[model samples]
Target: MTVQINTDKNVEGHDSMNVYFTEELRTTLARFEDKITRIEVHLRDDNADKSGVEDKRCLIEARPENMQPVAVTNYADTTEKAFHGALDKIKKVLATTFEKQKP
Candidate 1:
């Protein structure tokens, strides 16, 4: 599956970050790789330079083959936390979605 990572101005769009996100998504969504055509991860710093309880946001959109796309968002103090949180939510959503489509 193709994994794309994007970041807002407040977030760093470095090669290391891209590699980290790519690896993380590939590992976390390995099970759904066949069904998923592409995955887009959007990272943003809601409070910019300011710190808050949940200023980091992660939005993940998963495009499933021959099915509607699924999306989930999560907020946390760190990017990794937000990414993991959103990944968990997307996993549950995709599970339930595919389960309902089962014959």
Candidate 2:
């Protein structure tokens, strides 16, 4: 599956960050790779330049073949945490969706 990651201007979109997120997402969604055509991840710092609880936000959208896209968002103190949280949510959603479609 193709994975695309976008970050707000306030967040640095470096190679290392991209690689890290890509690897994490790929590993997390490996089981549904066949059913997913692409995954889009958006990262943002809601309290940019300031400190706050759950300031990091991650929004993930998964496009499954022959199905409507599914999206999930999560917030945490760190970007990684938010990403993982969102991933977990999407995984569950996709699992439930696929299960319901089974004959």
Q: Against the true structure, what is each candidate's TM-score?
A: 0.93, 0.95
User: Whole-model lDDT, candidate 2?
Assistant: 0.93
Off by over 4 Å in 2: none
Give the alpha-carbon lDDT of every model: 0.92, 0.93
lDDT of 2 by residue, 47-99 (tens): 99999999999999999999899999999999989999998999999889989
Worst lDDT run of 10 residues, candidate 1, spans 24-33
TM-score of 1: 0.93
Which residue ranges in model 1 land beyond 4 Å of their true spot?
A: none
lDDT of 1 at 42: 95
